[model samples]
Target: MSIQVGDTLPDVEIRVVSNGIEEGRTGPLFAGRKVVLFAVPGAFTPTCSNRHLPGYVQHLAQFQARGVEVMCLAVNDAYVMQAWAASQNVPPELLMLADGNGNFTKAMGLELDGNAYGMGLRARRFALYAENGVVKALQVEAPGEFRVSTAEAILEALA
Candidate 1:
């Protein structure tokens, strides 16, 4: 079933670079924290690069101040995620997680069909406020829309 507002996160090893150094076999990234996990269609796509990711990147400090650990998930692999992170000038802290096989995306029930666009599987734009791995607020956008899950909106939820 699709994960909902109160759903606890699945314990999956979503590949992540804990810092710039990269890490181990990977583990559940949100076992004990308040996390703002957002998913995008692809890494480096114009809207995701210009809006989705940067909105989080620029207001990272604001999120931090509110005790939100922001994470970005895309259907690409770790290497691509890392390269894109570097290109976006993301700070060391904002985690870029690779949902390479779309396992987590499917698990969360948010995969999008982009076969016509040649991307195959991807994620819809959405943000969830999770507390200790359970979602508290969920904001999912209709295809091609960006109004509801912006950083400002998530911050409002936090408030």
Candidate 2:
């Protein structure tokens, strides 16, 4: 089953670029914090690049004003995520995490098969509001839908 709002986030290894290359765990990242974690199917995809990611980047300060750490996650590798962040010119405060092995995505039961497009296993588009490692709210979109996971929607929910 997919993770529910009341579920504690599972500890899964993910990658990030810091100093050089580094591996980190979700549990530690969410520990003692309120996080706005959003996932996309892949990096550099049209919808993801143009809309999804830009929404977060644009409304980042609003999230932070509410004491939320904004994060963008995808099933791509650390290198790809890092490069995408740079290309998007995302602020440093927004965390870009890579679920390269799909471990975190599978653990959350959010993995999507994109083999038809040769993308392999990837994350479905979704967003979660988590606090202290426990999920407070979760919004998952239907396939090819981008309605509820947008930054504006989540910000409205918070308000």
List model 2 lDDT by residue over 41-150, tens digit each: 99999999999999999999999999999988999999999989989988888889899999999999999999998999999999999999999999999999999999
Best by TM-score: 2
TM-score of model 2 vs. true structure = 0.97
Clashes of each: 0, 0
Question: Residue by residue across 1-159, what tens digits does model 1's lDDT show?
Answer: 678988887766567854653532223578778899888999989989989899999889999988889999899988899999999998878988888898888888989999999999999899998988888999999988998888888888888
lDDT of each: 0.85, 0.92
Q: How does residue 106 of candidate 2 score in lDDT?
A: 95
Ten contiguous residues minimizing lDDT sum, candidate 1: 18-27
Give lDDT for model 2: 0.92
